[model samples]
Target: MKQNILTGVLLAVIALLVALPWFAPYFYIFVFTEILILGLFAVSFNLIFGFTGMLSFGHAAYFGMGAYTTAMLLLHLDWPLLYTLVAAMALSGLLALVIGFFCVRLSEVYFAMLTLAFGMMVFTIAHSWRDVTNGSDGIAGFRISEFGLGLDLVMGNPAVYYHVTLAIVVIAALVLYVISRSSFGLILKAIRQNPERVAFCGLNVRSYRLASFVIAGIFAGLAGALMAPFLRVASPELMHWSLSAEPVLMSILGGTGYFMGPFVGAALFVLLETWITSYTGAWMLFLGIVLALMVMFFRKGVLGTFLDWWMNKND
Candidate 1:
């Protein structure tokens, strides 16, 4: 019954998303696009942090790498947008593989700190390398030519881009959902709960962790790739440690235990920011208060807490 209800709710949400561009204003259409992209980013982070129990403080490294990859390809190579996205994922996956190889060797806070260190290293490189990355100003003014597959759609139109973003994000979300349901995902959860026991069962815990990290990075890169086109710039700010914290907050806000929790958290965060910023410059203060309240009272996250209440009431 719970699963049925959840499925119905998900379908309803997807329907609304599909119809949103038609009804929503142009500004809101772009806002929703941001929400989808950031939601995907948060979900990717959750794969590593929530499922694998790896508290990485530097997940934005992959996101920034992907954004840079897409921006550079579009500017220099003038590759199709689809091709750039592929390249972004590949490069991000490679970076994750290298970082995770060492980070996974450690556990607990050590792993987290190591990841943070590497993340800073990436940030520093992006900030100082003016020739290639264009320094702190980052990459900008890249033209969006073809979306590939011989589709001659107008890439400049906001509505058209929203639809494209919607399609790509939906497909990516579905893929991540499948991964979460697979045996590999189950093993990840087991490792999260008890790594020693997983090791005892002859499964390589570190290997699984590295795999999760790489997969998360690939998705993060995809999210970043989408972002660069929407924002029309790839800035070093995207790779900052502060940006990395966004997904951690989102996962905690949405409920780390559930597959869709991070996405829910991202939506809440974006919506709140949109509403709050209209009234005051102290939006961050208000956001911090809300997060504190959530942590104190709704530790399971808004969606998770609501689900529990619904199930209990039904019971």
Candidate 2:
């Protein structure tokens, strides 16, 4: 009954988000776009951190790689959005495979440090490779041309772009949802709870972890692709250690245990930033307060805590 209720709630939220572009103000349309993209990023991170028990400190590497891939292609080849997105996912997945091959060998802190090291290496490449990456200036002024399907669309139009972003994010989120609910997902949850027990059950825990990492990278890459067009610039900043922390923070704030937790967390994070940054330079201080409170009182995450109380109260 709880699962059904949760699913209904999620569907309703997605429906509202889908229609948001129609009712939201012009500025808010863009804000919601950022929230959706970042929310997806957080959800991808939660797959390994919350479900598979891996804390990756360098997730922004794939996100950056995906963004760069799309930016590079659009700048040089002028390819369709569909093909560029496919390329972004493929490259990000490959990067994950190579990195995960070694990182999965470690556990806990070691795994995190390894991922962070790898992530920084990628960041360095983006930063130092000035000939290709354009140094700190990032990739900007690249035209999107069209979104395919022979439709007359304006890439520069914020409203049209918001709709496009909405469609892609919805489809991608649904796919992620499907994966999180499958038997494989169950095994991942088991792996998170007790990897040793899963290994005793004749499964290679390392293999499962690696697979999860690669899948997360693919989705993160897609989020990156979506982000590039919105930001109009893919730079070293996207690959920074700080950018990687955004997802981690969102997951903690929303409730990592639940699938929709990251989304809720993303909305809160972005909205808070938007509202607070306008008034003072101490927005981080306020954000830190909220996070500290969440850690102390809602360790299960905002959504997770609320659900537990609501379910228990009704019972």
Candidate 3:
């Protein structure tokens, strides 16, 4: 019955997304596109944080790397969007491998701090390396000519881009869902609960953690790749620690225990920010208050709280 309810909710959300472009304003198309991209980004973060019990403070490094890779390829090589996205994922995964090799050896705060240090290193490189990254100015004026696969798309249209983003995000989410449900995913969860027990079972705990980190980085990179064209620029700010905080906030706000929690959180975060920023300059103040309230009262997050209530009422 719980599974049925979850399926119903998922289907309803998908249906709403499918119909949004037709019924919603052009402005909202862009809004939802941002939500979908960030939703994917948050979900990627959950792979390490929620599933593997690793809290990273520098996940934005992978995200920013992906964005920069896409922007540079588009600007200098005129590569197709699809090609650039693949490149972004590959490069980000490599970066994660090198970083995670050292990070997975530590647990808790140490792990978080090391990741932050590496992330800042990447950020500093992007900020100082003016020749390649265009320094702080970033790579701009990049055009999206085709989506690649020999299909011509009107990449400039917001509605068209929205549909494309929707398609990619849904596919990526499905892939992640399968991964989270697989045996490897189960071991990752076990390692999260008790790494010593997992290690005692002859499983390499650090390897699993490193694998999760790399997978999360790849998906986060994909999210960044999608973001570059939508924003039309890839800046050093994307790699900053502040940007890294977004996925952590979204995951916590949506509830990391469930597969769809981060996405729900992303929707709430984006929508609330959009609504509140319209009326005040102190939007962060209001947002912080809301986040504090949610953490204090709704420990499970909005969706998690709703689910708990629903299950209890049904029982």
Residues 1-315, candidate 3: write the lDDT tens digits. Answer: 887988998899899999999999998999999999999999999999999999999999999999999999999899988999999999999999999999999999999999999999999999999988999999999999889999889988899889889999999999999999999999989988999999999999988999999999999999999999999999999999989999999999999898899999999999989998999999999988987888778799888888888888847
Which of the two, 2 or 3, has more lDDT? Answer: 3
Q: Please state the error at residue 16 of candidate 1 in Å.
A: 0.9
Model 1 per-residue lDDT tens digits across residues 1-315: 877988999999999998998899999999999999999999999998889999999999999999999999999989999999999999999999999999999999999999999999999999999999999899998989989989998888988888899899899999998998999999999999999999999999999999999999999999999999999999999999999999999999999988889989999999989999999999999988977898779879987898888889847
Candidate 3 shows a clash count of 0
Q: How do the predictions measure up, each by TM-score?
A: 0.98, 0.96, 0.98
RMSD of 2: 1.4
Model 2, backbone clash pairs (residues 3+ apart or across chains), number:
0
Tens-digit lDDT track of model 2 for 250-282 = 999999999889999999899989988889899
Model 2 weakest 10-residue run by lDDT: 287-296
lDDT of each: 0.93, 0.91, 0.94
Candidate 3 weakest ten by summed lDDT: 306-315
Clashes of each: 0, 0, 0
Q: Candidate 3, TM-score vs. the true structure?
A: 0.98
Could you tell me the lDDT of residue 127 within candidate 2? 96
